[model samples]
Target: MRSAYSVETVRAAERELMARLPEGALMQRAASGLAAACAELLGRVYGSRVVLLVGSGDNGGDALYAGARLARRGAGVTALLLAPERTHPGGLAALRAAGGSAREAAGGALDGRAAEDGAVAAGVAELIRRADLVVDGIVGIGGSGGLRPAAVPLAVLARASDAVVVAVDLPSGVEADSGEVRGEAVRADATVTFGTHKPGLLIDPAREYAGATRLVDIGLRPHLPPTADLEALQHADVAALLPSPAAESDKYRRGVVGVAAGSARYPGAAVLAVSGALHGGAGAVRYVGPAGDAVIARFPETLVSAGPPSKAGRVQAWVVGPGVGDDAGVVDEVLASDVPVLVDADGLRLADRAAVRARTAPTLLTPHAGEAAALLGTSREEVEAARLPAVRELAARYGATALLKGSTTLVAGPDGGPVRVNPTGTPWLATAGSGDVLSGLAGSLLAGGLDALDAASVAAYLHGLAGRVAAGEGAPVGASEVAATVARVWRDVVGGGWAAPSAGY
Candidate 1:
């Protein structure tokens, strides 16, 4: 699994490791890794012209030390110090000692002298424009907000230039913990992070600024905490988690998933939900609702029943809500079921929070921002602003596992441990009936014996992979198309003849 720790956790780990090592050892490790990555980017360091946007802390120290390394290898390196007075003394000496030169970006220009107001220094701008690469070291974990005034123009210039830009640690101006961008942030072609992956490197908004991320392990493993804030499932991890059928297992033993979805108004929801459930490895899918006829017509394999969830032929798990518009009885029946439950779509709106809280079996609530806002009596904007906090709040308030779906879908438990963020899914998944299909798939996984969080994340990942596959050749895809492609997606995940998509990381 690709795990990400919070900034606080990383800082604590760094502190502990720093205490055990000799002075400047941690910085050297970070700098050496960073220099190696830079060398790769430069193709060959011997003739490359490299510019460093120096800050006032360890971040700048890393750049300076890296610059010193490149200088020793015959690269032309220059440090453009923003905070000259507070520059790292050891790094400065290292750079000068290795044949590198330290130059002050003329207060407003790129040259080594303070420039007059409102005018660009010809020589400074020319040097920046001709550089082979630029390294962003303006801020680190200790930085509070956006780029300082001195770093703004430099970032803009780097962006406008053809030179490759690599950010150290993180793209400055992003909240490393929450992936929130407060103001102007550096957009790098690549970002080399130290110790462990930060949440911003995996999440959106901030993730967009961090082009490609690489982690540098500096022996901080012993100091790392047992739990992290987020994790991404890898191939081997998913392979281990997938359920295998036993030789003596029967359909009933495998597990049945009951889907209580759809109504006369939107009958397609039932078909899509059942399609998802069947692809999700359920022994059998029992359809329970007004749309049973529609489901039976589309999928003859489904066991159709015109009743509520309680009498839905002994299902191991129940998927409720979806398209049961204004039907209080269906919602009531789903809540009364003893099996694990997955609530989604309009059902998310109809579910009684208190009733869900009282259930002894595991309950998973999957809601997009709007539905989640309605459940919490808040605005969708509020939920989007602080997604992690809002998801955790919902989980705690309802005493259930909450899966808040969006660009970065989060799964948080009631007891408040680490929240799992789904790194899959694409913008194309914004199509209709997607959530209904997801709920049914998650219910099937739950019935197949995975825990609430695992079921939710795995279903989400598969659904997203299916969407990408169905969206092949750049055609617009429907929800049914996504459901139809789930089997192929599963095959790919299970290492059965399918290849991983070349475009994805």
Candidate 2:
């Protein structure tokens, strides 16, 4: 599993590491790793035109020191200091000694002195345009809000250039803890972070700005705590959570997932939900809705019932509200049941807030930004901007596990543990029936005995993988194809000598 720390945690860990070592030792360690990464990106550093966008912080110092190393390696490096007077003296001296050049990017001719940030500004843009690589050290994790007006132009110039932009530490202008980019922020081709992975580098908005991320170890792991602020599960971690059938296992012994979805107008929602459940490691699927004929037509294995979910046979877990429209009856029946329940789509709107909170059994809510905004009584923009806070608040308000689905899917529980961030997903997953497939899949995992958080995380991971497979080579794929690919993905995850069956769906 990959873990991400908040900025405060990273700083605390760095402090302890720094105290244990000699002066400047940590900086040297950071600089060496950064220079090596830049060298690798540049392919051949010798004679390469490298420009460092220097600011007034340690991140700028990191860039300067790395630039000094590149200078020593015969790269024609230049440091464009945003704060020339506040530049790192040691790093500046080292660069000069190594035959590197320095210039003020926003003072005198570059600043608004003579012709309104004159010929030097144009000259700096040209340098950025012609450079082989641009190192972004404009701001660090400690900086917040957004880029200043002066630095904004630098960011724009670097982006306007074809140079490969590499960010030092966290990308400038992105909130290191929140992953929010309020105003202007540097969008790099790659980011080389030191010590540990910052939360911003792993979450969205900021993660998007950070095109590709590389972590350089400076021996700070020993100083960090065992628990992290955020966690992302790898294949092995997910494998352990996967459900498997034993030699003596029977269909009833495995687990049963009940799905309550669909309407006369949207019968395909029922078919799609059942399709996901059948492949989602569940022993049997019990369907209770008005679309029994449509579901049975798609999959004969489904146990369908026209009655309410209370009489829809025993279920380890229930998934309600895909295309149920305005039917609040089924949602109330599922909530009243003793089994765990996953609420989504129409269910999210129909289920009473008090009923959801008062449920004795575990509840999992899956909501997109718009749905979440309605639940929280806020705007969609507010929820989307503060996704971490929104998911946590949703879980707290509903007294259930909440999964906020979007570019960066987040799962937060009512118990207030570290949030699990899902790093997989495709924009193509925003299809008609894709969310219904996800609800069924997560409900199956819950039936298979995983908790709400595990169920949501694993489901999101598999759903994303299936989406990628279904949308192979950038083609638009149907929701049924995504469901069809889930079984193939499940086999790939657990590796039980199981090959993907041909066209069973």
Candidate 3:
């Protein structure tokens, strides 16, 4: 499993590790890793032009030290010190000794010369434009609320340049804890983080800016707590959670999933949901809804009934609301059952908050940004901007496991714990009826005896993998194709053994 910690936790761990090491040992280790990563990115360090945007923190020191290493290796390195008065003095001297150059950034204290600001800004811009690589060290994890006004132009210039931008520890200006990009922030081609993964590196908005992330071990793991603030399940992690049948297992013994979705207006939703459930490790799929005929026609093996879920035979779990439209009665009837329930789509709108909160059985709520916004009485943009807090609030409010689906699917439990972030997916998975398949798959996992959190997270992992397989070569894939490909990806995951997660999602 890949884990991520909050800024506070990472800071504490860093302090603990620093106490055991020599004064400059930790920084040297980080600088060595940073320089090695940059060398690899540059392919050849010799005769290359590299520019460092140095701030006033340790991040700036890391960049300066790394630049010194590159300079010794024959790279033409230059450091634009944004804070000349507060820059790391040792790092600057080391760079100068390694035949590197340092210049004060534009708009900073420069002998009280206002006329030089324009010329200095132009020179900095030219240096960035002509560089082969740019190292961003404008801020670190301790900084918050996005970039300061003085550093904004440097971020903008680095992005506008063709240089391969590499951030130190994190892309400056992003929230290290919440994965939020409040304002302008440095966007890197890759980020080399020290110790372990930060929460922002794994989650959205901020994740998009991080590009490819590489972790450099600095002996901080032993100091960290066992539990992480966030966790992303890998291939082997998902495979271990997948339900498998024994030799003595019968169809009834394995499990049965009940799907109560679709209406006359949207019968395809029923067929799609049933499609997902049949391949979700469930021995049998029992569908109860208005679109019974459509579901039976598509999958004759499905046990279909044109009545309330209570009359649809005994099911281990129930998936309610994909295309049920305005049918609040069916949603109510499904929620009234004793079995585990997954609420999605229109059901999320029609289901009562009180009913959901009072349920003793496990409840999972899946909602897109717009739907989540409606549930929380906020705007869609707001929910998308602060997904971590929004998802936690939803789970706490409804007393259920909340799955906020998007480019980065996040699953949060009712009580406080690590929020599982799904790291696999293709942008093509955002098709119509795609969420219905996810709802059915998660509900089936619940029927297969996985807890609400595990079921939701595992379902998301498989669903994303299937989407990637279906959308090979960047072709547009339909929702039906995605559902059909789930079983194949399941086989690949279970049979292929463990595979580490790729760089960017």
Candidate 4:
């Protein structure tokens, strides 16, 4: 799993390192890694023209030190000091000793100083446009929101220029903890982050501006936290978690998933949900609802019953509510079941949060923003603005694992553990019946003996990958097609030919 720490955790780690190591050791380690990444971007450091947009903080110090490294390797490096008086003394000396030049543009001229402020701006702009690459060292974790006036024009010039932009720690102006963009931020082609992965680099908004992220270990292990706030599961971890049948296993022993979904008005939802459960590693799927006939017609393998969930044959897990209408009785029956349950769509509205919390078995709630809004007595806009807080609140309130579905699906457990964000999934998944498929897939995983959070996250990942595969060539795809494509996507994820989806969603 790829874990992401909060800004506070990162700061604590940095402090611990600073207290133990020699004064400049950490910065040097960070600078060395930054220099190596720049070398890779330039193809060859020798004879390359590199410009550093130096600010008044440690971020600029990192860039200056990296510039010094490149200078020793025969690169032509120059620094445009935005704050000459406040620049890091150690870094400035190192750069000059390595033959790097610091130039201040004349009052709108390219020569010597024309007032420090004016010269810095013009000098940085000119150097940015002419250099092969530009290092964005304008701000770091200590920075507040937005760029200082002096750094704004330089950022604009860097963005407009052909030079590749590399950010030292993080792209300036991004919220280090929440990934929110407060104001203007530099868009880097690549970012060299230090010590650990920050939540901002892994989540959206800030993630978009961060470009590609690379981590540099500064050996602050002793100070790191025992747990992270968010994480993304990898293939090896998934492989270890997926259950395999033993030698004495039978169809019943492998686990059966009971599905309560669909109504006469929306029969396709039942078919799609059952389709997802079948490929979700369940030994068998039992369906009980108004759409039983339709499910049998589409997938004869599913065991069908016309009665309520309590009457359905024994199942290890139950997936309730995809297209079920306003039927409080059916919702009650599903909620009272002895097995673990997953509630979704219309079922979410019918469910009594208090009763759900009273249940002894594990319960998972999967709700899109609209459904979640209805359950929480809030607006969809409110839920989206503070997704992490909302998901956690719902999980705590209902005493169940909450899976909030959207662009970045978040799964949170009742115990306040780290939330899992599905890194997979495409916009094509917005099609109808997609949520139904997800409900069934998560239910099947639950039946297969995984915990609620694991089942939900794994199902979400597979469902998203399937959507991407089904939407091949950029054509729109329906939910049923996504259900049918799950097998292929699962095979690819397990090994046959699945390339990691391009970094940012």
Return whichever of 2 and 4 wins on TM-score: 2
Clashing pairs in 4: none
Candidate 4 residue lDDT tens string, 1-505: 7777887888888988899989999999999999988998899889999998888799999999999999999999998777677789999999999999875422355332444343344445667788898998878876758776556677788889999999888898777777666677888888888887777776666777888888878786668887988888776666567667899988788899999888999888788889989989889999989998899988999999997777778999999888888877788898998889999988898988788999989999999888888878899977875577778889998999999998788899999999888878888999888989999999999999999999998999889889989999788999888999999988777773787654521
What TM-score, over all chains together, does every model reach?
A: 0.93, 0.96, 0.97, 0.89
Return the candidate ranking by TM-score, descending: 3, 2, 1, 4
lDDT of 2: 0.88
CA-lDDT, candidates in order: 0.84, 0.88, 0.91, 0.85
**Model 3 off-target regions past 4 Å?**
108-120, 497-499
Q: Residue 297's C-alpha lDDT in candidate 2?
A: 88
lDDT top scorer: 3
TM-score, structure 3 vs. true: 0.97
Tell me each candidate's RMSD, in Å, in order: 2.9, 3.8, 1.9, 3.7
Clashing pairs in 2: none
lDDT of 1 at 8: 83
Residue lDDT tens for model 2, 69-93: 9999999999998878788888888
RMSD of 3: 1.9
Which of candidates 3 and 4 reaches a greater TM-score?
3
Name the best candidate (by TM-score). 3
Clashing pairs in 3: none
1-505 per-residue lDDT for model 1 (tens digits): 7788888888989989989999999999999999999998899899889888888889999999999999899899888877787899999999999999887764544443343232333454666677888888889966757776567777788888888899999988777888777778889888989888888877776788888888888997789987888888765666677767899988788889999899999888888889899988879999998998889888999999989566667988989888888897888788887889999888888877789999999999999999889989999987886687788899998999999998878888888888887766778889898887888899999999898988988888788788878998667888988999988878888984545322122
